[model samples]
Target chain A: MPAPTRVFLSGCSMMILLIGSLAACVQTAPPELLEAVESLDRDLVAIQGAEFAPTEYARFVQDWAALKGRMLAEEDVIRWPWEPNPLAAHLQKVQEEGEQAMAVATQRKEEDRRDAEARLTLLDRRLRIFNSRVDEMESRVVLGQRPIETELLVRQAHSFLDQGLFARSLQATEQASTLIVAQTALLTTELKRYADERLVGTWRQMARRTIAWSRTNQATAILVNKADRRLTIYRNGRPVVSYQVRLGYNGIMEKRYQGDGATPEGQYRVVKKRDRGQTQFYRALLLDYPNAEDRRRFHKARRAGAIPAGAFIGGQIEIHGEDGLPMSQTLGCLMLDNRQMDKLFEKVEVGAPVTIIGALKVSNPVALALADLEQFEEG
Target chain B: MKQPFICYLMVSALALAGGCAQPPTDKLTTAEKAINEARAAGAPTYLAEDFAKLEGMLTTAKREIAEQDAKFAMLRDYDKAEQLLAAVETDAARVNTDATKKKEEAKAVALQAQQAAQEAVKATQELVKKAPVGKDQKPLQAIKADAQGLIASLSEVQTALDAGDYRVAQIKAKAIQEKSLAVQAEIQRAMTKVGAAKAQKDKQVKKHSSR
Candidate 1:
């Protein structure tokens, strides 16, 4: 029974043990190898949070997937057989590539973040300046009538910045700038047009003639430039002093007829001097505004239908002191601050020659721009 | 007689191996639960990449279990399947934590950006009030149009935020803030130029008057 039977049994057992061990070796993936692949996959996922270049990321992903597929396909290969596992080497290469990609992605994200932050910082500063300027312009010119359009542009620029569309943001900003500049020019021109127009050649000629007459007669004379808002006193043909003055509410145009609300232009002479309380103003120097030249012009205008036919060439035009109202509040009068009126009253008498002109100087660009703005605003 | 003994030995070894190789159901269930928790924690929105990786690991874990189950009872190794499931569980938990943190961060960034955009709009409105009205009228109108566009973009950003797209919202808000600021700067520059021009003109006038 025994010896032959025992030998056969021993050989069978040995063969079974060897086969089992070999199957185990071939069928199971090494724990370390599996862990490495999993780690690489996790890294790849982490890099997705970064703004990696799409093509590069895709290549990295493809390599990783290919390596993973090969590893899974060769799951039955022994890790440390007679030769090293081909799949393991491939996996290591893929893992390294993945790491590099992740690093690049992380770097790219940081750069993008920094760029965004920098742009934001710059934009914030610029916006603040623009906003303050708008406030100033409103207070100084438009008188708080904010432009709805500008508000819309700023909002758009903000939106572009939010989207990280720097180019678009800049475009909106540039448009806004252009608007601001144009508005500024308009405002400047509107505020300065009257003053600028007064400085023309015809007005200067009359003013020069008045000065020459005053010097020859050794008489006191006055020259008023409505545009410059100034009144100059001359004695014996020499300029003595000047004072800021205000004009009629509608003083920008030459006076043509009665109640035009315009200070009359051209040469005249003071017909009377009234003390305080004698006239509506603090003091008054009445002028013969409808002298021959004025009456002639008035009649021409009336005939040409420039003014109402029945409208008289109003008289009693005066250079008067303030009546506690705006400088331009008088009815066809040249108004002055009370202090200046007192000084002029002391120095002048009746029959003084007076010349009222449009402007004292040529119009500058700012004035022109302001005038344009005013025109637009009025329209 | 020896053949019977050998057969008995082989049967006992097979039985032990099969018993040990029962599907790692407990580990698989735990991993799945962790993955669900990560999803609930907003991993898909705030930590999308990490969440996706966790999902992949979970898929691999399930596949490994299926492979083990398909094998012959004597050859099956549930230990490897269990290990994969354990890895998945770990990854899922990490994803949940990371996602929560990222969500909070994204929300904060988005909120800050929204506030900045609002401030920019307000500033722009003020500027519009003071904008010039003359020859620059056309340009001013263009600026107004841009501002309107920005206001519209703000709504879009809000929509993105509501939809849980915090990254998109944050980006939009940032762009708005930057662009609005640039506009403000441009206005300031224009104002300065206008003022300087006026001053120079006044100086020239004074020189002429003195002469």
Candidate 2:
């Protein structure tokens, strides 16, 4: 009985302990497997895989949980040393799927970021281009509040981009672009006459005829091209000098009657040259506006009900100085800066022939600017 | 005398036959309710990263519960899932509080942006008072229009802020402020031209006086 029996029992217990230790080693996750799973987790979290690649992310998480549950449930099971670890293989597959999800999420987030950036760029470009046209047309009064509304929308879109609201940012940008296109269309319609080759040709012909007349008479003549904002002087059928000029507040319209803020169009003469302090607008070369043709047209309009009952053929039109003021607000006149006026006041006598036309050629500033804006709509 | 998971399974089996080892229903409900509250507090918007982490935790908990339910009833365990659910509840609540605080901060930032834009527009208007009236005829009308446009844009910032879209309001106000500064720069350029012209005129006047 005894010492020999105890030693045999101890050896059996030691054998069981060695087998248990080997089984636990099989259950333990390999270092590479642990690293792969952990890395995949980090990538998913970093790229917001749950939000961007929801389906794939869910599958990966389920697979990972199932693997974890199996590893824990089989912790005490015994297996042979040479048998492959199925858990390691399964973990590999799960990590691969998770990596795919990460890739998808990364690509989607990048696409959204690019989309938001593109919309921002387009909106910014449109704002700049449209604002420039509005400045040139002085058409803010005409389009009232629309440009302001568009600006607000564009800004809101930019804010949405900042807050990672790509869809909202794109929507707002689209809306602002629509407004800009509509306003550009309105401007296109308003300035269509400037694009008309026939109308432009007629105006150019009128200027040419006046220049020809200057050559025939061999006397000093003045030509005012309103669209170009140029006033040129001709001596002996050749232009000797030119100056930049300003017109009426509503300078685009052809003059009609008394108090109409429109510069008249036609041939005329400098009836009086009022020198320093003689006129309110610094200096004046008062033109003989409302000539025979103007009076005939005025009466015709009055009879034809195009003119108001009390409307009269307007007068006192002049080529004048800007009075050294910062702004040159004109009413039914062509105004030059004081520096240019001094030169003009000395060159022209009281009876010099002066011709005023809207433009001498096609492709005026207004026409060119409208075409640039149209490209945005077309693109 | 048994493995931890096996011992847990044995205990679960000995519990009530039909209602044995339930799937953390109360904890799940609390976590779901907290997540909804966090969403209402703007967690998705103001605390996106943290909210995303909370959502991931909820998903893991739900998946763990599903894994446990798939096992035989006698071997069911909700321990890991319940711990995750408890974490989700705590995290969701923290996310809600943090989001609320972030939204308030955004609102303050938006207000500051609006005030800055208003000040920029005011400064531009003051510059407009000195805008050049040259023969080209641009600075006065264009600057006035820009000033008016900026003023009108600021109202939109207020509307967005009232609607609780702080980012939109902030961006609108900031853009308007930039536009106002740009307009002011243009006006300054025009004023410089005006000054140059005046100096030339003064030189002429002095020459005439000497004569």
Candidate 3:
């Protein structure tokens, strides 16, 4: 009886020991933890966790390593299945921490991206408006390298954005935008004279008179609108058509003297018609630019110290052809492409009236651009 | 007396341990100074990618130091942080060298553009001199004004170059060159018109005499 009892007890003790050893050797993990960690990994990369939430991400990384180390160490231990597996609970806690970090990272990234994108959009619009005004005044030479610098900054901002450095990109764009705003302010102020309603009314009235002259005499007339960048022909009070024309480099300003780069605002007559060989502008209708009114204004400006004492009353203003030049800016002249000039050259004879004005429409493209610039400045 | 002796030994041991646990502040300062010098040398503009990587190294080093700082003093370690800072310093020196070289190249380019712009302005001025007299005078004067504008922009380029803003100088000089070329084209067109008009005037004079 003693030998049999001893053998049974020994076999049962061995069985229990082997079962406990098997339980301890088995590496058990919460199944959902794998999927949860993987999901957090994806979001972490997507949100640039290392960049946006570096400290938290580093902590998560350290916890992950510790959990793996604990799991590996537990593989050699012998314990009953009833014992609580700390690895699973540790993994669950680390996963929760990691998930929390990823959530914060994603939110921060979205907020920074939104802020940077809005700034970029505003800077882009400001640049476009600045460029337009530059073209309008042909002020490229005046602005020097500012436009180029602003453009480069925008390109760099886009590069930083591509690298997910939103704050740095925003800083670069903000610097570029400051220059654009200053330049635009200067240009808008320079061109503000053209927006004066009283001056515009005078120009419009002068244009109306020229059209009335055409309708009364059943003859052709020419109207140059600086703000519209347009030259329209009226045959017997009806607008025959319009063509895109380039004015002076500083054409928005009323002409004062020679080399002023202003297209004079006045009524005139096409005193002579010079066909291609007769004129240097490909073909030309020479105009009386400094009529009595022009001389009177020039004298007044000189007396007021606005014009230099040595300045001459500029002459030879004409309606002319572009002759295939790429520039749209003219020297106080109404310019047309050679093909358009051919049509215009045959439409009117010498002495057909021509009137030049600042603006005929209140909401021309240039005026609208100035208004947009004001809104930008107000912001 | 024995307890006081034991306390002195512990104090010395703890002091040694604390010294070992301290962050490599001197290395961090050296690395930060190097980064600043690199930035001042225009590394951010010319060696942008390499500079960015260097900056990333600095951030990592700072984080590593911060990690150690958050640990118990007796357990803190700065060996990894010290390595990161050393790397940053080395890379920052390389970036500074590359950026200076790039800036010199840009300066040379800007000078070349300035020469081209100057030549174009001269050529355009010559054409303006030969432009037809009566009708082209006003327009030719305007062209001269444009040439003057080009000259003024060349001055701007010089100012930027003098300020060590080679990129800005290059941009200004290039713009001047482009505008000068356009003005030259315009003057050539005017010269052709002048020639044509002279030929026409000759033909007219001959016809009237023949009739």
- Each prediction's TM-score versus the true structure: 0.41, 0.75, 0.51
* Tens digit per residue, CA lDDT, model 1, B1-211: 9999999999998788676667888888898999899998898766666665566556655666787788777778766556666766887888889888888898898998899988997797687666542212223544555566667768877997898767667766776777778767766665666566557767886999999
Please state the error at residue A2 of candidate 2 in Å: 7.1
lDDT of 1 by residue, A256-306 (tens): 777766678888988899997797677989888788998888889888998
Q: What DockQ does candidate 2 score?
A: 0.29
Q: Chain A TM-score for model 3, please?
A: 0.62
Candidate 3: segments with Cα more than 4 A from true spot: A1-106, A122-149, A183-187, A211-221, A229-246, A249-253, A292-313, A324-329, A337-352, A372-379, B1-211
In model 3, what lDDT does residue A134 have? 61
> In terms of DockQ, which candidate is strongest?
2
Ranked by DockQ, top first: 2, 3, 1
Q: Candidate 3: which docking quality band?
A: incorrect
Cα deviation of A17 in candidate 3 (Å)? 18
Candidates 1 onward: DockQ, in order: 0.06, 0.29, 0.06
lDDT per residue (tens digit) for residues B58-163 in model 3: 7767877898899877778787778777877987898889888997898888788777867876776676666542333234445555666565656777887788
Q: Write the per-residue lDDT of candidate 2 for residues A1-379, one digit (tens) a residue.
A: 5999999999999999997868655655677887889788777866767667777777776666556655666566666766777777888888898888888888887898798889789779878978888667555544555776787678678777876667788898889988888888877775666677897888788788878878998888999887777899998889999987777755665677876657888889999999887987788999999899899888988999987999888799999987655456676788887778889999999889899887776788767767777876787
Q: What are the per-residue Cα lDDT tens digits for candidate 3 across A265-353?
A: 88889999989788767788999888998899889999999989999998998888854222233667777777888898999799998
What is candidate 2's CA lDDT for residue A131? 89
Superposition error at A220 for model 3 (Å): 5.6
